[model samples]
Target chain A: MEFKKYSKTLFFGATLAVLAGCGGNDAVTQDDVNASTDGQVQPVITSDGSNGDSAVNGEQLGQEAQNLQDQASSAIAALPEVETVYFDFDTSVIRDDSREVLDLHVAYLNANPAQNVVLEGHADERGTREYNNALGERRGNAVKNYFMVQGVSADRIEVISYGEEKPAVIGHNNAAWSKNRRVEIKY
Target chain B: MPFKKWIKAAAFTLLCVTQQAVADLTIEITQGNDRATPVAVVPFAWLGQSPLPEDVAQIVSDDLERSGLIRPLSRSDMLSLPSQKSEIYFRDWSLLKQDYLLIGQVRPSVSPGVLTIQFELYDVVRQTRVLGEVISGKVSELRSRAHYISDKVFEHLTGIEGAFSTRLAYVTMRKDEAGQNKYELKVADADGRREKSILTTYKPILSPSWSPDAQHLAYVSFETGRPGIFIQNVYSGKRRQLTAFKGLNGAPSWSPDGEKLAVVLSKDGNPELYVIDLNTYKMKRLTKHYAIDTEPEWSPDGERIMFTSSRSGGPQIYQLDLVSGETERLTFEGNYNARARFSPDGTEIYFVHQKDGIFHIAAQELANNRLRILTQTPLDESPSVSPNGSMLIYATQEGSRGYLGAVSVNGQIRYRLPSQRADVREPAWSPFLTN
Candidate 1:
């Protein structure tokens, strides 16, 4: 498990550097590729375990890279365009208005077996910071449990609450706070 | 023509003399009771030494009345307005049921811009002056000087430090012409007077927490297009950005020792509580829960941290001991409880408790595990105890607009300060005044 984790970290570093180098109009500059490899990618690989057998390292790195790519593609394909699920003030119970958005997430999760998503809960600035944080987590868990009941694996869905720390709207009025209390699904 | 010029000068001097006479006089009350100290504030007599810029007597009277502890006997009730304690007759005041009397006069200072206010607080019952002192300040600061005199007199009699000199920091949000939200951080006198905006931004600003020293304020601002923590000095107006991490950087709480700050950061893909050393900017992750862990407030002793975590299947307040690495749940009476703050004595934790579908500020005694609701407001949040732990301030909504409110620690004497300019929220009481 330790070896697998190290290999996966190295693969992620390399892929990030390559992606940075690939964004160009000119024939990929040697400096761009070299900079990506030397300045960015090589450090991460060396830190993970460069003294290990290079052949085994390379094969493991390849397998981890393929798995990450598959996960990325699956996540993209399973993405539901729904941006957020709104809730009433001081409430964690998902409303009818947010039910359609949750349904889309449920369908997306069922269609993509390898994909999992985390729900980020948020609240408006109406209450105290600590109360809003708790309220946010409740909203996130509400969405997570709904997805689990719809046949999505419990292990695939995670819930985290941001509370009133982040708001979609900054208004002090009810209109702003109402829009701010919400849950966003991230894959 | 030369004689006419001298006459014009004489008229100007006469006009100034009357204004000076009206402003130089002041009054001081030396004795009072819990049932509103009744004292007569006589208008000061000008010695005609120099021109005064303000009505010192009225200023002193206003200060005493606003304290809610003293009631200045109306001038209409005064048998006579005497300018000096020697001129006041104890028998006349005794007939009027006045318990005390104040008399003073202002004179020219040695410096050009300064004035010396000599005052005496007299006990009408004893027929003697109980306190006598001369205070000097610039003419421009005459009102503040009067407030200081009131504070001294109140403390001498009541034995409680007067809060007249303190200020309250509150957030005000308003909608602007472009239909966008505007937020302002305002500091006002304890009586909600002399308001001044400390910081104004188009981005949202939340959680304005004052440092223990009262020189700086730490708050969460989205001005950089993300929720980040920024500390700004209230006096110097210099601000330092503490965190702008990629994902989430919100809820910055200062430690009791003022060496570290416990904040919520989500850079590692999940929101968790982390303590950052302000000096080195190094962070030690405190909670590893995949569930959200945020709103970290330090215990008074700095040995433990109280925060909100949803790991127990729902949101609840938990305390984490730094030395033992032990975690204990603190709230179980409600479905949701968060935003806990320790009292000044560290005996109880005050937080927002949601029970019976209404949210209120509730206090839980750590020793007995007893919970008591300290507020009647339906949506009270952000319960911040006073430096002395005598009162708690929080924000609650009335209709659609939010207002800042305060209640005594025993849950009596509740009052709300509703903003006419904008909706108010997130009130942070400053630490006790150093001076």
Candidate 2:
């Protein structure tokens, strides 16, 4: 087997502090492409916005996800080494790279049922603190929902949002904000 | 005794005691009211300690100018120093275009540690004494009394009641000795005097909302692992965590009656609005939408709650009727609007509105739905209206540091309350603080 070094495009230091984590082997796939295509993303709001967006059925999606994971059980083995996932500005929607890291975390969490993990979410300091708190929590909940879909119990995952209060990198520019808006998984 | 105890605890955190008394915030009046009443507040004759511990007249002048409605004559421009009505130089002040004059004498009272303060306001144009008052209080209470004198003088000249007697609660964050960010909850006089630290922690603190009576403060503190809503007495500094649910407990807004607090909690899956009864600890979930409904603020009538909700795909304020269980959209002009609060009279709603990728404090008249952006600066958030509903203080940033800025309700007067070292945000002006 070719042991290719996992690649990443994060401008943040390779020196992220992760709890119960290995060396940065967390494969970041499609992040550079996602960042370049961000200009094409439409504004989330429009007139009569609520009519088109329906509430996500988390439980039903969890069951369907569990069936998919049950069939691909052999492919998942070792826990993912990466512990941090970056998000788009003002959005908690999981990107492709973030989903890849979380999928590996789901494999790690499934292999060890005794293991419990905490998801701490954060946001850039562009918006109001309280709304950012909600945004951060939404990011955490998005990760937690993914874990539950992969057969992890709700109690095993703890979600906390710091809003814009705590920043991994302290600066006002987009470079710092992109790194700041993230979810860090701690085991 | 509680205040004294708090002072003792706060004294060590102070960097320079002398500088803070004179210069804390650099006030820049961006928009001047052409009709602003110009008044000269002559220096008050001090009869207290050898070197007066405080400058009472300067404090009063700062308070008046901070309000944006009054223009204080520069101390140098004063043709002559007058301390009483008998030393009348009305002709000179009139030449300087002063409409009114204020002078006072602060003398030691018969009781030890007490000073009897007297001040007189004269209408220069009318050439008659406008108002006169005498107050006696402990030396430590001199600053608050100076504000009191300004309040009386303000009300006598203008029909509106003065909010100078009020106080402010805000958060200041800076790097501590060990290079870790230290967050402090500080309470100060409206004129930025007697600033004392109520609570100092390494964790982040935000949303300092004062109780209706101004006796307590409810805020979001991250002291214990994660974010939690905490309430602490302003005088005692004793605090208790109101909620520490599993997911999120932030943005605590006290009700009008001071009986319940409207907060954002995410324990029941998504971030929803919840009101917690302060007496019984019972939680009443207000909204159950999958979309984020947070930053709950109660109207003065206590009948409706205005909150920030992304239920419309983006953050826009929505009003919830407490009795009828119905919600109505309040803000339709902006795709991003949050951190909404009410004016004192409940006639207007002030919130941070985003336009052209810049956030400005905007007010919506409840009667006609007229939208008016009240601030000139960018990235302004957390608009806390003054008790009298004249000006609102919000957070703005320059480079990476945050500073507090205030703008009048009419979008005319403006000033920035920037600190020398610390980055300050979340300034909650106290209600009419009656002692």
- Of the true interface contacts, what fraction does each candidate have? 0.07, 0.29
How well is each residue in B112-178 modelled by candidate 2, as lDDT tens digits?
A: 8888888999999889987988898876777778788888877776777899888888899999889
Candidate 2, residue A55: CA error in Å? 9.3
| Residue A179 displacement in candidate 2 (angstroms) | 2.1
Off by over 4 Å in 2: A1-79, B1-26
> Evaluated with DockQ, which candidate comes out highest?
2
Clashes of each: 3, 0
| Predicted structure with the largest lDDT when compared to the true one | 2
Q: After best superposition, candidate 2 residue B166: deviation in angstroms?
A: 1.1
The TM-score of chain B in candidate 2 is: 0.93
The true-versus-predicted C-alpha distance at residue A60 of model 2, in Å, is 13
